[model samples]
Target: MFVKITNAGGYQYVRLVENYRENGKVKQRVLFNFGRLDLLKNDPAFRNIVKKLSDIVERTTTDNTEAVTIESEEDVSDAVLKNWGYIVFRKLWEELEIDKFLKERATRGRKIKFDADKVSFLMTIQRLIEPMSKLRTYHEKNRYFGFEEDIDLNQLYRCLDFLDSIKEDLETYLYQRNRDLFKMVVDIVFYDVTTIYFESCRADGLRNFGFSKDNKINEVQVVLGLLVDKEGRPIGYELFSGNTIDSKTMVKILRKLKEKFSIDNIVIVADKGLNSRLNLKIIREAGYDYIVASRLKNASKEVLEEVFEQEGYKRLDEKSYLNAEEIYGDEFKYKVLERTNVIKDEEGKEFKIEENLIITYSSKRARKDKEDRERLVSKAKELLENKGSITALEKKGARRYLKKKSKTEEYELDEEAIKKDEKFDGYYAIQTSKKDMDVEEVLGAYHDLWKIEQSFRVMKSCLEIRPIYHFTESRIKGHFVICFLAFLLQRTLEYILRKKGKEISSERIMEAIDSMNFIEIEIKGKKYLIKQRTEGGAIDILNVMKIKGPKNFMTYEEGLGFIGINK
Candidate 1:
């Protein structure tokens, strides 16, 4: 690398340029720019330093190329080392090949201020390691080792816009890459919807007030639908308006998968929230199977009676029975019944489809449900005693247990309602079109939906995906894309750890990664970086992730190499 001077804006600027080869052709990359050559020329000390540099280069090019070492006799201090956990994440990023993919796709014209791909990479890494606002990321960018990009706040926002524009293509590329890397089996996929609320009270077309999964009902939100493979790896996602219900998103997401991914013959596993006659018919007509939780209380009277009178219940485990043989544990007993249902098509045509309804009674769930109802009943009684009228909001909670007399204008406990609710306690059912698979397989597949739910939790709690600050629709979408990519990296790390028999939680992994830091010290004109190694889970994380921990001490340049920093 050598300094090159260029005249621009009636001033001369000195730029550090390096010659490199790309596509079998020579190229030059401007590494750094020192502004205003006149300032350097006016300083005698700077001119002397330039003369020394020129002499060194001339001697190195001549036959008298001898090794020159500088011995520092003066005492030196003031050296510092920063966190290096990002390096490990960088390795994983490269292993996933996302860096290369983004580099190839993140193209721009010649007038750009910074490399969009590099900015995007740093932004994603920041989101994963230390989530912050774009401004904060820009201000603290230099704190991260090897993240020396010269990007301003405006450039960062522009990069996000670029990311939003290429979101679809990027997701597709990632899906295919993951499939090849993990050998993903697309036969059975799990899907679920979650709501992420915004902090702003002002509602727009995309951020209208709706039901919040985080219980932020007063705030606006957006619904996010995530699809994952059988192994719980994310495949793709869709964002909907906050007012969009869970059931309404299934068709759109399914259609996207079918059209974009061309995935067919897969069984979609979801909770009862997405269960509807229309969704079921759509899944069937599209030649796909579904294993969805059924709202047993909402079933027809015949189905309820059959569920109550079904006698051929089987024990799922040997220790499932609490009282030896007579009293079975609610969680241990399961009964499955095969039934053919007639449903109407969009054209009013009737069709018969066979499905398996597996019902399991969980004593734990029953106890919790009973306790919850009793608490609500007590709250209702308290309200009645206080002569309080049930408002519309109260009707959604404890008020549901009370009945008001029209004549007396008084409230009383509804015995019939309690009894009806108690009858369904401890009973949960799952419906599946997979007739060939056993009840255990169907139940197991349905249970894996928890992974997708956990992924949502990670995005919201760990990554802070909610309470979005962006107002524009495109920026909002772009923000979610970053969150999704961070979630993908998190899931990929978990997958790698699990494959190595390490079974670590996402929180624990993040804790370990965040704690791996280094401290630098300088003495006698020599720099030293000491790894502040702690005796904790971080060590195990480094080992399991195959990341190199810092040695006793290293020079400043050596420290950079340790963290995979090219400079």
Candidate 2:
């Protein structure tokens, strides 16, 4: 069969010439690009037509396909704590000049071989807090630990002792740093106490058992008081007995803070649990402003009646939109707004809990709040089906008797009365010291309180900060101290991500760090090849964090350059 080229239709067409026998006669065919004629040798016409396209073929060969490889090069690397992730923390560390400060503080006593930066010993204690088989299994599989002569298993325990000696000095130095560089002079430090449990038996002056936040009712735990600035940098803290009352201990801690920092322009912010009348008077007498969540249900009946009947306060019922002035000082007026909640039972019974938003405006907001609260109770009661005394009037055992449907199940009305008194429970009032603070600003501070809640979650989940293994007081304190540092590191990373508007978590960051793997590759040459690979997320986070990745398998010389290390 032979084919011939035909015409170009402005557009082009290839005519195919075919020879065949049809009905015992010789026949010929032609094809064009317009329809079925588009076939070419498979036709020589198309190839010969396109051979003139030298530039196009060269371009197609170059652009359509090329050999490429993405190879990761790795060098010796260490997980140095200082990095792009902790910008603010590094700034704070610089501001405090932690190394020099710790050295200066250490000079007050004896000379120590290793101090703040030689924290490998302290880091050992942190490892013990890890889940038992996880790290062990990790090292066994990785075979990386024994690669260095000095990093034997015993080195871990030795480091723990080193950490043990310097732990107190570390904390003392941190406290000094806060006072010298980081404390908020204008805002009251929000201080609260919690307890951590340990398995060991060693006791000290402070780690006595009281109420354990860890829910280890039978285990003896040590109390921990943390005072943080508005920005969440820990400013000061104290270790107390586990059994101490939250408010009583809070006052003692505050008094110490008062003496140490010596700043009187402070306003204490705490929950209702710390708002005892005695505590309030003590703080007030000490000349500090106070913004405590009030137990409105505990108010005197007459006071509550007045609050309900009065009608001058404005209750805001929306998110905050206050400018910066409302948050930082007392000069702003409290904008009184009422907040209401509708509680519904499983069976469709509904109840309304009406509360007042008492924001303090310089000094006038409080009076306005008082006026509004006088009206709040009456409005709240209007929603109550029976405004029967929310308060209990009598003792349980004086007169009430009880009967049971069966003799086996005896119940008393007095017990029922006591239970009834406990029913109207739950926090009621949401107040702020700044009246000019927008509704959202007032609510936002309350929301910031949730950071502590999340810190607890990280402590338990990501950091493995619980399930007390040490029974001794010092070790327990040391355990939490390291955890606190880890928490600091974690939050620092989180803060950076937040400031950058990047959505990532502490666990993910740590996981990224831990997941980073380095390997050794051998070639028939004197060159050593180190291969580093990471989880996909790690690469993404590193990119977001602005860390440049190595282009090829990095040699020892190149890897050392990456980490700023030299032999």
Candidate 3:
């Protein structure tokens, strides 16, 4: 086969022909016609096609006419080029049905410059893989296997606007999809809140100067409340103003759960920050149970005495105990006691709610508390010795160990205060409305709260959900929505890996996915992608995630098919 070029009437024509010997005569038959070689040469697609055909012809002629010989490096026209690693994540996204869901939920209009669903899909994939600005995502489109080739910056901004408009519906759809696919249950819901701050100093109604978990008190912030199942998969989320207190946000979250999701009869697990009398009452009135941590030092004297005197503590392990008398290094001990608290309802009627309190003590916590107190006392002594103004330390409460002499201006160490703090060291309390649950069961359930905390860490550190650049309220919400979806997918992947007995972390998996790339080479107009061997935990990740490992080589189209993309 060869390309036969002909010029006639100031027009150049190119035809692909196959040469053969018929009846001892050399003859050629046209295989393909590439019209107007001048025009075809300027068109990259057509030029690549012609080059591929020419290479095939040359190889065929060489094989038929001469002895085969290895080609030198210079003779090879192939060069390894671009590399992309997002294919694994893209595959996982498809497996999670995100692409299908977006296609169905996102509205596409004929007048739009780009596919809305495609843009949203790319944004989400980028959020999980790279997490860059929209403009950067467009500028670096080629780095991601040309997935965003058609998407522009303006289209991306509009896409976020559209995404914000459909955020609620999209979240509902994702929740249902995840529930059906993972068989997720809502019996036990873990709820927690984190603060994401904005870089801008300007505060909007949604972003206000309040408690900043990131310690950016000067900057505006917002509160993000996330709810997850027992397996740490995100169920839903709510965004509130930064000034909103953690306790105040629970009512809204519970209402959403009951009204929107129709999920009641759940046992909410949270940290001590959300454990308020009002929050507890709200939980009970909503017909739900709660296992919340409580401040041990705040316990009534009678309850504290009872905890100290209680017996029959079961030993949980070698380093932990439940109601044991002796305390060892890092020894954990717990005592279950019933507490009757009087509370007023909305009608202001007084009533008593009997709740079980699990007081836990740890020797490790004791040592840490002692060391912290000593440091604080040292600071206090320095202030006293220097006769420095005590007002500052007194206001900050670090001078609790320093007592002023009743009749004199002198100050001395408050041995009594130090003893009081020492007694409560290594002791914390957990209160639960599940009276029927044993101490061990309640403690274990509360321990799972760390999963939700871990989810927050993933969002803040891995997803970089904080320091948001978007200033508009809708865009800010949309930003969080994207991060939330990213976190959901990540948690789902982690859940699957765990189910398969692969104890890999989301961070490690992300690193592996990022490192898994393909080497692309173009020769004779044919583009080939060779999957590079993955290193580190990527191997086990691919196996457990059911993703195919790298093959030796495949065509570009075949590579696209591997990631559930065609054309």
Candidate 4:
């Protein structure tokens, strides 16, 4: 075959001409026409073809000197390429001893056909790298270099069932391991709750409609109560019915986690959502201290009168001062209001609970408060203008600002309510039982609550924990267990990096894992592996794991060894 340039319809075209002898005479015919030459030159695929041709020719000269390899560029296209980035996570998984735990459980149960440990590993790794449904994860087994298709979709489901069976054991095992190995901090832990909603509206014993943190009012969901140590390392988690209130789950989680793990002198920290008179009483009665945010908007008339006093407030720094552009004092200030309240247990016995409500104000927080209020106001006015037949019954968000006129059903923006809300802007109050602790310590503990919140984001977004499709309660709980393990592994890697001075993110770690691809090519009869060079946080991870960097070229045995397939 030969390439020939010809003109057709006033356009220059490239053609593949093949020559052959039929009877006694030789004849030539065009085999294929590659459209216009100019367009073909600009096409990416064509450019790739040219580059591949150039590369193979150079390689044939270079590689043929050592072995019979790479017959053509088509051979290169026929080679298998897959993500081997999981090698990093695999090491971490084994180090956590999850494999040993699952295998031991498998031995205790009836003789199962499939490997629960392997399937669980598959699902957890999928949750870390790219979360998907169980059936989808089964189908994507070949997407990894060392992964095999020994287990089917049914096996993955069975693994979840087994995981549900040993959920508590697994949690306890991890808690003990972390405490012993990492010196996991339990002196003070942060606990928070978030709702994971399902796609279907069908309710079950465990899944029902509740006050969704996700604002998924129409969807059925299950509340997840997560407990993390001071450093944000997960201690354990619990799943409650969708109707379970966030505040109600607090005492239950704290009490159980403490008893199960033998946590000592644990002080719990949480947001205002879990801050209630009853919760505080139960916590105190259980011999645990709590630092929770107090709702400044819910203050009584006398409390507000005392909170707004300027006599005891202190400025942290002069950085908040404004020159010529602001009115009142914009410096960040804080004041502690001490109060004693009697909290009673189930026995009707009352005890005095002393608390220091740390009230803080800042110009930056003031700006954000104003912006958020204006946004709500904008949405409120639009709601009023379009308030056709919708009954405004003082609902959440902007609707709370809409008051009904007198006894009539008609609604309008309540200026008084707006003014009252604005008065609390830039002001934040934290109620803590630790009266002896300094102000900065109290604020610092409250601020670390974001780490637990960030963990929820990791579960919801990165791990895709919601929109659950499982109908059975065990499956739902098991799915959460898998997601929790994935999140733990990711956080463990991040913690390792933080200690090593890298300070990488989970998203970046995922990207780095994704970029570690390897090409498996067959040369003559033997196979060879070629790794694509990577320059990302994956390098840091591989180094931290004490593994050699992937070479440009490796034998099949070396590739399998590198992926840790043999042992």
Candidate 5:
């Protein structure tokens, strides 16, 4: 409880009271305001007496304060949270041997901005890569964040410009080691393609209007293909024209990576958008094993016939029924059906929307299918009802009345039903290509593509990867690179928190960091200390990661730990 005290001079005083009950008896205490107590200097002794009395009165308040101690989930101070991404980036940068990797490239001098070594370079990269906020506000009260108001804003812009120049160098740095970095225990590599809409419609070199996935035909967009390792850290990314087909992209990116990085012996995983015959051809020709969402309809007639002829594939709820058991090399088996539906619009031209039933040998796929079936049943029933209504309206005597028509009379019908055959509920034909793998494992691998889709959601929602304002090629690249980095850092923090079974969002982590009040407190004339007040949960997370106090902030020595740094 808070109480306000006012003097004749209009000065206000605030006091806090704490109350508790012990053994069915109530206790009350009061705490005088520090600044307010000092202001009552006219009667020094009397003021001192009042303060002592207030302290005794305040004993009850301390009881509740001591009862619950908040925990610090992570040392997510503004500087730490903001720079945490840079730390992980530096780690991956060194692991991938980006510096030595860059030196070998003949075009290194062409992009002088990226080729050079500057502390600002890494810092700038870290800044852009930070999660999305219109303007960065980190540790404003902490002077150590080193934001000097006296410094010209031009200098900050220069830093941004310098960082923007090395866009390609940064890409090459990460791309060159794509495979070697994941040579060990790399179980899953998620691949995804998404479009970023731009403000301008004019097509330059790389920017063009294609299929706007966002349904914006007037807006020019670019297609971005990204690859991430099992740990959810980004490995590489490629930018292509918006019209670029997903199926055609994998081979080009893979070929570029194979030639540039000298990589082999890796599994390529993608969703249905990338499951093309030509793409599969390239995957096979390149000597790379791939797990793709097999298009049953696209399978060869011989393969489909083989699948249909195999009586073992039809077994259900047994080892063969949409469940996993060892069959192929550490794999499982399941069955699925390709489904298609015909549609006629206002013009009566027929088209079809093909779908698939992805049976799985694994529980993951089964659960997904179960949920999908539930949702589909709900939607399909609704659609059928809506279509039934339209059919009923067309039948004679179905309507209650008819509106006036200049030269026509209307007829109505009762109990009219749709004319379409319900037997067509299930349609289309196709089969899986994974003859060697179990059906469950194949479905599981294919559905895992959802992880990449989730990543795109984070990129757009958390990082604001779209709605780019910059028009120059360098600025455009810089903007995306930064958004990516921010995502990387945000994901890293979430990963660490999850390991401890604690849940906190990247935005909340930032909010906790912001809640901190860093005061330049002077206890006495001669003693000064910088105090950081954060909850206990936040600190616990930070301690587990060995990031505590002011000392853990990155130092030159830590940066030197990265490969090929010229300290």
Candidate 6:
């Protein structure tokens, strides 16, 4: 509602009007006529009317935002007694259209006993802020302001299965949405694998024990292959068995990108761990390109000589990096060596492949490498003092630098092995199928691989996606899907803030959000929200999103409005 001036018969009158929708049409109605505009223009008349309305609003105003009536006084006893942080996140949630997508799925599917959309959102927001077990989330649902839906533990468990049923479709939808929303370019994707371990030692087909990156050898684990776009926004992800090797995890994710997402003509960037011959052949056969770290230590002697040769090495100039002088000094340099390499396919047939190998050197890397070897050699010397305790069963890495005398068991430091290892220090190499790409572009694409690694850290620490408590495979998949979507929202928020010239990490975002506080109180049989002190950057976050600040005392409806809900 707003004030308007109406002109009729060559005169003007003051009017209060409202715009409403009726029968799919917008119409305006004059709510009140406040006498002639000439009279109201007199200072006293205008002041009196304004004061009267202001007085009436506190006592009698009732609108969708002013009040949301509860069923009875008993419901007031169960109002949100503590805090909520969904105001900013819900805005992001709606921007990504997750609520709309889930609503469509819920309404279109067979009817169920629970609110599927609300339940799905509850899981996602919980993972985003404070991760916990599904049962725990169900038990604590009333803590958040908007989760008044009647739900139980079984419904939460079932939602995971619901999510699993639409995993591929959901990924496809998110990819398209992210592209449209952020103008994200998915042409170059980074693929890397990590192991997510379970707390239990028991093994299932999918959760069998394998090499644990966490060093939990006795526990079961699952291998996760994550594919992210250039800026670290997730495109899609795949789950593999616990024992699946890194090289073997590539094919399935590649198939997902091609078949599920319909992404064609893209380059997959990865580290040396996934650079197996068979994986490369499969990628080439499927018509995709790659940029993977090279296994320089295992290279043939001739190739190693060419890599270390001084003739072809070109020093990296200041133009190599955007913040070149600040990031890399004059000691950083690189050289690209081209060669015909052999690749083996699934059928064991070898084919000649032309590739450009990028080799880089840094004085800083050499110094660090020297210190690391000296540290290991120092450990080897410490072991020489106690040869009896060095057992074959103990597989510590530092033990490899020790050499035993041929006739006796006395151990001595292997100078030859240490010297041989020193030759490759300060040098790094990257192999790429796109030979036409400039050295800087190749280096830039390969350097951005850390974004994916940072993403993994965000999920494992901030999202807590691992330690699968669900026994069923579908629920496990669903759990990951929930966390993955939450990550997508978090990253999207970060990206938007970055565009606005505000930089924040996932850790700081969660910190500020968790510090937001509020409580519910009853006054004259009407429930209202009493906002507590909000800490950190809560106001800054809202300002960036263009949301109005919450009043110190607001109706429950107003609180709901902050989360994009209306009666």
Give the per-residue lDDT digits (tens) of candidate 2, residues 1-567.
Answer: 243455556433443344657799987643112123444335332343233222222343466442121121121121111111222233334454655654564456744444433243225223322333223522432232111223434433333444456665665566665555533243646656667666644555655556667767666666666766555555556667767777776666667657765666665667776766566556655666555576665655654554444355443332232343344323332335555434454567655434345533222344454454434434333423333432342322222223232564322333453343333222145544444545555555654665555655666677776566655455555556656665654555565566677667766766555544333322222222233344435666555556665433444455446543210
lDDT of each: 0.75, 0.48, 0.74, 0.78, 0.49, 0.78
lDDT of 5 by residue, 1-567 (tens): 344454435565434444556699976443333335345456333333344334433442366632221122121111121222233334444455644543454244553333323223243333434333223322221122222223332333343454466555665555445444434345446787889898888887667888877778898888999877655666667788777877667866786557754556566677777866556556655766566655554555554554445354443445444233432223334456554434454577655434344432333443444565445445444544455443433212323222223464432222112212121122222223334455445555655666677778777765667866666676576566666655655565666677777777655665444433222211112111222344435565555455434422123233224212311
What's the candidate order when arranged by decreasing TM-score? 4, 6, 1, 3, 2, 5
Candidate 6 Cα errors over 4 Å, as ranges: 1-84, 107-111, 325-330, 393-396, 523-526, 565-567
Please tell me which model should have the higher lDDT, number 3 or number 5. Answer: 3
Task: Please report the TM-score between candidate 3 and the true structure.
Answer: 0.79
Model 4 TM-score on a 0 to 1 scale: 0.86
**Model 4 lDDT tens row, 366-471:** 8888899889888889888988734635567778778888998778888898898888878888998878887767777887899999999988888889789898
State each candidate's clash count: 2, 41, 3, 0, 42, 0
lDDT of 3 by residue, 1-567 (tens): 567887878998876666677799987665455567776677444545556545544564576642222222222233333335566556666766777766665544424456776777667767777777777867766656546366678887877777787787777777777778778788889999989988888987899988887888689899989999999988889999989999889988898888878877889999988988888888888999999998777778898787677484545754234333343344776777777867786789876668988877778777888889889888878888777668544624458888888898788888898888888777778899989887767877887899999899988888877788887788888777778778887888888888888888877877777666655554434566655555468877777756665455567887777655411
Worst 10 residues of 3 by lDDT: 67-76
Give the C-alpha miss distance for residue 72 in model 6, angstroms.
23
* Predicted structure with the largest TM-score when compared to the true one: 4
- Is 2 or 3 the stronger prediction by lDDT? 3
The residue ranges of model 1 lying beyond 4 angstroms of the native Cα positions read: 1-81, 108-113, 317-331, 345-347, 393-395, 406-408, 522-527, 565-567
Candidate 1 structure, TM-score to reference = 0.81
lDDT, residue 220, candidate 5: 81
Ranking 3 against 4 by lDDT, winner: 4
* Clash pairs detected, candidate 3: 313-322, 313-323, 314-322
C-alpha positional error of residue 316 in candidate 6 after TM-score superposition, expressed in Å:
2.3
- Which sections of candidate 3 miss by over 4 Å? 1-85, 108-113, 146-148, 310-330, 345-347, 382-413, 523-526, 565-567
